[model samples]
Structure formats: structure tokens, C-alpha cells
Target: MDEHTPLLYPSPESPAEDTNAQCTGVSGVYHRIGLRLVGSLIVDSIPVTLSYILQNSTQTVSILVTGRLGPEELSAAAFSMMLAFVTGWCIALGGGSALDTLGSQSFTGGNRPTDLSIHFQRCVILLWLLFIPVAILWAFIEPVLLAIGEPARLCKDVQAIMRILIFGAPGYIAFESLKKYLQCQGIMRASTIVLILVSPINLVLNIFFVHYTPLGMLGCPVALSITYWLCFILLILVTLLSPTHKANATWGGLQLQAAMNLKSCFGFLKLALPGILMVGTEWAAFEIVALAAGKLGELSLAAQSVIMTTDQIIATIPFSFGVVASTRVGNLLGARSAIGARNAAHASALTSVLVGSAIMTAMLAARNDFGYMFSDDEDVVRLVSQVMPLLASFQIADGLANACGGTLRGQGRQHLGAIFNIIAYYVLALPIGITLAFSTRMHLGLKGLWIGKSICFGSVRRLTHMILGQVIGLFTVGTAEYIVVWLGTNWDKEVEKSVVRNAEEAKRRTLLEQHE
Candidate 1:
């Protein structure tokens, strides 16, 4: 059998084993495993998180700049963003996760290096196809929102915002696919590097397009579209020109064959649909909360926005860690190193706790001043302060849920994560949150919503462990290979060393791509 194929073909189903015992038997070199795992995650996650944070910040900067023009401009931009988030953007986040599975595994699996290239092609085609419906849906958003009883003015403005925004859809999803494709291969720094460089350009473009050009409100989407496409283009250039990519020679020039495999396209869908739901359901639930907050009154909605925005930024830490965990597990599994995959998951959980505690502390420290960053109103600031404690608690719980979610993705069990999220947020948190948020006696508003979410997070954390245990079952894992993906990741020269070693061990690598 091809050595890399073991991950695809597991040992026969067996009797259940103690989860604690299985985790303990991870290895005698647990200390080294922990260090390596932490190092790998830090390597992959830091820059990735930074890049995404900056990217989100750049968009925020654009909005802030627009807010200066008038409240109407700001409202339209924010509403446009909300609609984009639920539709095209959700597809990007979740659908790109498919690469977290297939791309990572294909690199270490017994496939030609070109397999990664083909997989990249397949993802681009698949995501673009999925985005078509979304683009068409954008065309009709005005009437839809109006029919649903959104204010006619708000719907009219939002419609104008989306019209121009839909053109950017291709660039957005394409960037995500490429980002995941390269991330799985260890070129982690390129994203941050590109975003940092282009984000300023986006800011400048927004200014010029809005005032200096004829686009007016349409400039917002147009400038952003340009930014997204540039980010995508820059990444492709960086990957092709980088020495590490040349060393691997993973990209054969793109060809018709890259998009020809309809069968594999279906496989991508199988993995992607669950990832889509996982990210989509979470985002949707939050949007619902935003709408609920809106119903409570303008103050409540503004306060929720302030709190949620900060939380979203802080969220990058755990979300990035989960990305690290997913990539690590997928890489190890592909190399048939079950021990390594198991160790990666357990070590990541510990790392998340440590990180979560720190984030919780930071949130508490900033509670008094956090709202002022977004608003000057004393009521909004005071309201945000009341909820900061709950928000802090939610961070820790969020850490656990996201950690488990990432591991589940690595295991190619995203459907489980999706199911858990649906139950946690939709079935559990949303109902309770709405009840508390709207009750005349309770009228908890934003605090109630956050509190309910905390409960949901607890449930998600517990269920993650149970689900992980079930999927992993029993296996004798060994530290035979220590993989470090995301090539430009700042994690020592280990990845560089791996490349030199891999070149020398080409035959064996073709069979397993094992790391020493």
C-alpha cells in the first residue's frame, strides 16, 4: 500500500476505549510533542491571525471614513456588509475550509505535487459556481428586504450598496481558496504580508473613489472589490516567485485538467457543505441577535455592535488557533501519523486555555474604555460596560468551542461541528437569548443575548470533546513524523530543513511526505 494512503484507509472498527487512556498514550515524549505542537500552531496562526485582523480592520477603517461623511452613508455601508457576510462571505469562510481538509491531506498524501495545484483549481471553480447564486440574490435584495418590512429607505440604500458589491464576489472567494491552499502548504506569511500592504491601498482607494471619483456610495464596494482582487493577485505572485514554492514545485502550470474532475468536485462539496453550515450558522445566529438588538431599540443595537465588534477582533486568536489545529491534524493524518494528530489536538486545547485566560483578562481590563473606541455616547458606553463581564466569560467558552471545531475540521468531520453549532446557538442560545432580550421583566437586551451565548458555548465545548473521542476511537500513534506546514511561518527553520530533507527523500516522500 502507498504509505500516505493509510489516513484514507483506517484499521477495522473496534471496541471503544477510554478517551483518557488514549490521550495519555499519545507518547512518552509528550513534552517534546507539546512544544512542537505549540510551536507549529504559533507558527501557522500568528501571522494568519494578524493578516485577517488587519484585513477586517482595513474594512473598518473604510467604514469609519465613510461614517465621517454622514450617518446615512455609514448605515448603508454597514447594512451592505451584513448582507455580504451572510451570503458570499459565509461561502468564502466555510467553503474555503474544504481546502483545510483536501489541500492539507493531498500535500502529505501519496499524490503528485500537482495534486495540490489541481485541488486549488477545483476549489476556485467550485466556489465560483456557488457564488453565482449569491450574486443573483444580491440583485434582488432591495425588494426582498422591503417585502420583509425593512424600512423602504434602508432597503433602497442597501440595494444600491449591494449592486456594486456583488462584482467583488469572485475576488473574495478566490482569495479564500488561494489563502487556504497556500496555508495548508505552510506559506503562512504571504497573507499577512499582502493584507498589510494592500489594506492601506484600500483605504486610499475608498477616499479617492468616494470623493474624487463619480461613484459616490458605489465607491465603497468598488474600492473594496479592487482591494480583494489585488490581495488575490498579490498572493499568487508571491507564491509563484517564492523560493519555498520552487523547492516543492507543487504548481504545474494550470491546465484544463485542473477543473475537469467533476467526481472530485462532488467530494469537495461533501466536505464543504458541513464547513459552510458551521461558519454560516454561527454568523447567521449572530445576525439574528443583531436584529433582535435592533428591535430592543437603537441604543441596544449600537451597544451590541460595539461589543460584538471588539469580540470579533479578539475572536481572531482562537479562530486562527483552530485553523492551525485543523491544518496540523489534517497534515498528520495524511502522513499517517495518528499519534501526531492526536497530540496536536490535545496540545492545542491546552494552548487555547492559556490564551483564552489571557484574552479574558484583556477584555476585563478594557471593559471601561472599549465602547469609547466605537462611540461617544455615555449610555452606549455604560451599556457596553454592563455586558463586558459576560463578554469576557464568552471568550473563554468561545476558545474551547473554536478549538474543538478546528480539530473536528482536521478530522474531516465538519458536519459534526455544524450540527453542534445548530444545536448550541439555534436550539439553545438563540431562544433563551431572545426570551431574555425581549422580556418586559428581564429585558436583558445585549447582556441577555451574551449570557445565553455563554451557555451555548459551554455546551459546544463539552460536545466537542465527546465528538472528538468518538471520531478518533482507538489507535497506536507514534512520533514517527513531526510536520510543520505553512512554509513561510516564522517557526524556526524547521520547514526549510524539511524541504531540503524532502528533496533527498523524494521516493519515500512520494509515498508518505513524512517529516523528521
Candidate 2:
């Protein structure tokens, strides 16, 4: 056997002996495990959450600048953001979905997994290449906006923003690739540190470009692009400092063959496709809501932005938990302890609920203050406040779905998650929400959009949580139960085999002694 392979089987042990040490629940022995898991998650989640907030603060600044320019500019910025999201950010999610799986898998595999860095580099190159055609399509953005009945003036502003953003697509993809690399090595905290470092720089750039330069709305995109590349560089530098990256065979060089292996490359694309669509579909649904509101007029569009900004900020909380849970669950699964993976998944899911509930309470209590953080206008505040309840009510479900989805992805079950997302977002949420937001005469208006989102979020949460929980029980706990049962049923047979082997070894030893 290879030195790394363990071929020697252990002596057949009685089930009773094992059961004597098996943890019953979270009472005594399990309690410490639970605390450690939860504590680790919280510790990791904090920096990540702060990074997300700081990163998004640039958008806040952009919106503030746009707000000063009046409604048309604000609408233009919103339109431009949606376009940037679809073409660039959405693709990263797809590529990143693959990264999350492969990265975690490699971490589990040890030194050999380190060689997978070449694969990561190859994937990033492929994504950047793929983005070229998409970038070229930026020229048609104005026509598309016009086709959608967007105001001519707003369409022009959106075009400028799109042009600037498209220029930076390669950098954006690179940044995402680096993030996955760090995340997979169990050194995810590094990316958060880089994000924190880049955020203030981004803010200053945004201010300079908007106020000092002639870029105006275009400066927002310019600033963001610069910050993104900065974030990428920082991650790459920090990651290279890690011992694991040092020990890896795939760290350096432009070995075209190794860097561009098609078979493995295609596999990654396949694994990531569904995740890309799932996130894209959900994001597209929101963009549609914003578009529809824009057609309604500036106030509706502004209101949507306010609600969305808040949602995006708050979303980091659930997202932080999900990322940690995914890593933890992936680690346990890769370790081959199905029971441990199940426990980790369950703990993560429950922790999500607790976190979500806390966020829900906080948001609900602060519903009155939701808009003031952005603007002093009574109309925007009133509209946002009216929609706050719907948004707040769905927080727990949203958090649960995010956490469970991460758990599932960590287990290489992203396809299952993608299906749930399609059914929830497309079949249940979009149609219903759009109708309510546009057609309803209940005087709810944008509030209807919020309600529809809540409904979608709630539906997805219940379905995913229930499905994931059952899966964990069947795969993890059920596997453990089978092992326990088998150990009990065939204890005598195993013991006999062990004895026979031992006797044969003794006979060989005596024969060797006589020959000597």
C-alpha cells in the first residue's frame, strides 16, 4: 500500500464499547463541540460582515452622489448597477460556486489539493476570456434600455456607467477567484482584511471622482473598478504569505497545459452553472422590480433603492453565517465523518435561525429609523417604513435558506439547492411579487414588492431547511446508525477473521525462526 494509504483494519470492536463513548446529544461531551463551532462561526463572521458593509459603502456613496443629481441620475445609477451585476457579479457567483466546492475538497485532501491552485488560476483565466463577449455587448446597453421604454436621458447616463464598469470586468473576476483561493485554504479571514483595507481607499476615490473629476456618475464605476483590482492584489499578496500556498506545487508559473486543462476546466464549469443561474435569477428578479418601479417614476425607484440598500447591508449578516457554515460543514464532510458533518449542519442551521430572529427583531424595532439613515425626506421614509414590516418578517427564513444552501453546497449538493432556488424564486416569488407590485390597488405600491419578496424568501427557507435537514439525517446520522448496527451484527465474524490472521502471522514467524 502507498505510505499514505491505511490498509490495516482495526480489531472488530463491540458496538457497546463504541456506544459507551458516543455523544448522546449536546448535553455534556457534545456541548463543547457546539460551543466551539458556534464561537468559530461568530469570530469569522464578524470581519466578513464588516468587510461587506465597507465594500457596499461605496455604493451608498454613489447613491448619495446620484441623489444630489436629481431623480434621473439616480435612476440611471440604478440601471447601470443592474447591468454591472448581471454581466459581471452574477458570473462570479457561478465560478465561485465551483470554487467553494473544489477549494474545500482540496483542503480536505491535503498536499495534493494544494496543486489545485493551477486549476484555480485556469478557471479565472477562462472566466476572464468568457467575459470579453459580454463586455463587447456593453455598446448595445443604451438600445436595450430604450427598448425597455427607459427614458432617453436616463438611458444615456446608464450607458456611460456601463462603459466604465465593463472595462473592469476582468479585474472583478480576478478578485472573485482570489477570494475563493483564500476561502478554500481555511484562511478566509484574509480576504476580509483586504476588503477592509480597500474600502476606505474606494470611498476616497469615489468622492474625488464624483466631486473633483469630470466623471460624475462615471466616477463611481471608475472608483469601484480601481478598488476591486486593489482588493485582488491585496488578496494575492496575503495568500502567498501562507505556508500552505508555499508548499503547493501549483502556485507559480504560466504552464499553459497545466493552467488550461480542459477536462477539469469543464467539470468546474458544470458544477458552477446551476449556482450561477440560481443567484442570477434571484438578482434578476430584484432588478426587474427596480425597473418596474423606475417606469412608475422617481419616487418609486428611489424607494426601491433605499429598501434594496438596506437589504443588501443586512444581507451580509446571514451571508457571513452561511459562508462559515459552508466551510465547517465541508471540512467535516471531507474528513469522512458523516455524523460530524450532520451535527455541524444542524448546529449551523439552528444558529442561522437564532441570528435571523435577532436581526428581524432589530430591524422591526428600528423600522421607523430605516429611511432616516439615507434621507430626511418624509415620503421616502414613509414608503420605506411601510415596507419595513414585510422585509423584517422574512429575515429569519432568509437567514435559514442562506445557511442551509451553504451547507448543501459544501456537501457537493449544489444542484439540489439550485433546483430549490428556481422553484422558489421563479415559480413562486417573481410572478406573484411583480403582480402585487404593479397591479395591486391596495395603495401598497412598493410595499407590495416587499411583501412579495418576503413570501418568496419564506417559501424558499421552509423548503430548503426541511429538505436539507432530512438529507443530513439520512446521509449522516443514518450512516452512523448503520455502522453501529453492522458493528453489532458481525462482531463475531470480524473477531474470527482477526484471530485467523494473527495465527497465520505466528506460523510464518515460527517457520522463519527454524530456517534461521
Candidate 3:
């Protein structure tokens, strides 16, 4: 080989360019991207998860600190936390999915991408606009709780918590919007850094305000609200300083035409609304199980809470993988690299399955240990131990469903996804599970709940795999291969032709010179 000759790999134009090339089959590049995606998921989830844990943690903490408080305080804290979780999570983060969809398209489109500032502005407008009714809902929360069947004393406590938590809505939404912007820009490390710094601060604030300070229950939301604003500020500060953010025109002045583009803004709402409902319905369904467990009495409720917390932490692993896949697939699709999109989906799905299986095994091995750590009561530990196997059993199927849903959402097929989830979870899975839970007499009251959960999770997994199979067929596999083969063959032929032509010309010149 010539010293100056460069090595060439098989490409679509010259050879078969494997769709797998874009996948994590490559070493350093694959792992680096993987780490970034996983890191983003962990970092992004920390505050939210901590918020989830902290909010829940506050109930017990409140009960502990507020000595002699009756069931009223407990129930109020519960309702407040519930309202906060549903609103903060479902609205703030849910509404921000518009960024995952649009920001992705913009990022990949690069040259002709929509104005980042306009997208940000429009989302902000829509987010704030959506905030009005939810805030109103927060305002009338007492009457609503009263109407729903909550005890009068409990209603008062709930009302106080609602009013305080409600104040955090604007901060929650604003911070979430900023997070989406940073994530879309692939600048999640900054968000992570900020959150790590602020979360402990929030925790300390939660303890001090709830236990010692005059704030009481109100202090929790106040602390959480402060952290949310802190997150937004840090993200904005990072956005201003990052070269990548500036390069993407994320800091561009907002054009009224761009920001007020109702057509485009509504387009985002169209994608986001169903996406929100898809996940929300599933969450609400699970909450129902928890509610049902509450009916089983305090031991059952506490046991379920402890189990659910551990379960949720485990659940985040697959969901996090889904997040990574969604971002990767969305970016690829937005680039119009259909082959790459397909490969990314396949890779992500496979990763979820393997990871899920591994987690399940680990959970099974440590099932008794996990339950024992949460409670010293033999009865609670024994009950939790019985339930662990069921949770462990559901992991694989659950992971597949979660990961596939992410892929579908990234593909701009959220409508189909929403329908599938509705049918799979609500129509089919939940019904079967509820029947097994309530009607079937296995003497497994709480375990029965998990039995239904297992069935529902499994059904969704099967459905997702089938849907993915059909979608995978639409990928540009044959076309990409054809392009690779044709480019290679034709380009080689042209080179051969040119070489021959040059050789003939050189010979002719040599003979003519000899004759002269």
C-alpha cells in the first residue's frame, strides 16, 4: 500500500454501510455517548426523584416533628404531596416534552432548523397559559377535596398544603422548560451539576423549615420551589456561557413572528397533549393500587409505600434507558437517517431487555434483604418478601414497554402510542389485574395487586414488541444498502475508466515523442 493512501471503511456509497454503525457497537464513541445519555437521565432524575422522595419523606418527617398531630395533619400532608406530585410532574415535566419533540427536530435539522428562541418563547407562553387553570384548580382544591369525600378536618390541612404548593407551580413550570431546553441542546451536565449542588440544600431547608422553623408543612414546598428556581437560574447561566448553546442560536433574540407562530406552537401542543395523557393515565392507574392498599390499613399502606419506593428506584433504571433511547432515536429521525433510527431503537430495546433481566435477577436475590432494610416488623417484612417476587417478575416486560414507548414517542408516533397504552394498560391490563386483585381469593390481598401489575406490564411489553416489529420494517434498510452498493460499484468503474484514459494518453505522447 502507498504510504500516503488513506484507509476507507465500508460505506453505503462504496459498500454496505451498516445501520449498526450508528449504534453502540463502536467502543469509545459509543460508551461516551452512552455515559452522557445515562448521566443526563440520572442528573435530570435526581432532583425530580429527590423531589418525589423528599415530598413523600416530608409526610413522616412532618408527623415526627409536629408532635401530637392527628390523622388530619397526616392526611393533609398526603393530599398536598399528591397534588404537588401530579401537578409538578404531570404538568411541568409533561408539558416540557414539546422540547424533546421540537428541539430534537431543530437540533438535527441544523441549517434550516426552527429558531431556538422562538421555540423556547412559544413553549413558555403555552406553559404559562396552561398554568392558569391548574392554578385555579389549586385555588378551589378545598371544595374539590370536600366534594370528593375527604373528611372536613383533613380538607383544611389539604387546603393549606395546596395553597402553598400551588405557589410553586410557576417556578416548577419555568424550571422544567429550562431543563428541556438544556437537554435538547445536549448540555445536561450543567443541569446535573446545578441540581447536585442544590438538592442537598433543599433537603436541609426541608428539615429546618418543617422541624424547627415556623413554616411547618408550608416549608417543604417553599424549599422545593426555591430549588426549582435555582435549577432554572443555573441552567440559564450555563446556556449563556456554553459555546454549543450559542452556536445553536439558543440565545437568539425572540422574533414575534417566530414566538407567536400559533400554527407551530399548536403543532407542539398537539404532540405534547397525548404524550402527557399516555404517561399520566398509567401513573394514575398505579396510584390507584396504592390507594387500594391504603384501604388494607396502615401496616399495608406503609408496607406498600416502602415497597413502592424501592420499586420506583428500580423502575427508573429502565425508564432512564428509555430516555436515552428516545433522545438518540429522536435525534436520528430528525436527521432523516431512518436506518440509524432503526438501529438505535433496536439497540435500546435490546439494552433494556438485558438490563431488565439483570435487575430482575439482582432483585430476586436481594428481595428479602431489601424488605428487611425497610422494616423491622416481621409481618411487614414477610408481606413485602412475598410481594418482591412479583415485582421482580414484572421488570423485563415493564422495561420493554417503557423503552419502546420512548422510541415511539421520539418517532413522532405518540398518538398511536397513546392508543396502545390506553388499550394495553387501561382497557386490557388493568381490568385483568383488578379482577385478579379483587375477585381472586389467593389470600394475597397486596400480593394480588402486584399479580395484576405483572399481567398488565407483560401485556404492554408484548404489544410494544409487536408494534415495533411493524415500524422497524419501514426503515431504509434496502434503500441504504442499494445506495451503498451502487455508489461503490459506479465510483470504482469511473475511477477505472479515468485511469485507462490517462494511461492511453501518456502512451500516445511517448510514441509521438519517439517518432519526432
Clash counts per candidate, in order, are 5, 0, 2
TM-score, cand. 1: 0.83
* Candidate 2 segments whose C-alpha is farther than 4 A from its true place: 1-33, 66-71, 243-255, 295-302, 440-443, 458-516
> Model 1 segments beyond 4 Å from truth?
1-32, 460-516
Q: Which one wins by lDDT: 1 or 3?
A: 1
Q: Candidate 1, after superposition: displacement of residue 430 in Å?
A: 0.9
lDDT of 2: 0.64
Residue 497 lDDT (model 2): 30
| Candidate 3 Cα errors over 4 Å, as ranges | 1-71, 110-114, 440-443, 460-516
lDDT of each: 0.71, 0.64, 0.59
> What would the per-residue lDDT of candidate 3 be over residues 171-245, giving only the tens digit for each residue?
667766776665555554555556666666766766777667787766666666666666677767866877766
- Best candidate according to TM-score: 1
RMSD (Cα, Å) for all candidates, in order, is: 9.5, 10.5, 13.4
Between candidates 2 and 3, the one scoring higher on TM-score is 2
RMSD of 2: 10.5
- Model 3: which ten-residue window has the lowest total lDDT? 2-11
What tens digits encode model 1's per-residue C-alpha lDDT throughout 377-421? 999999998888777865655666676677677666678778877
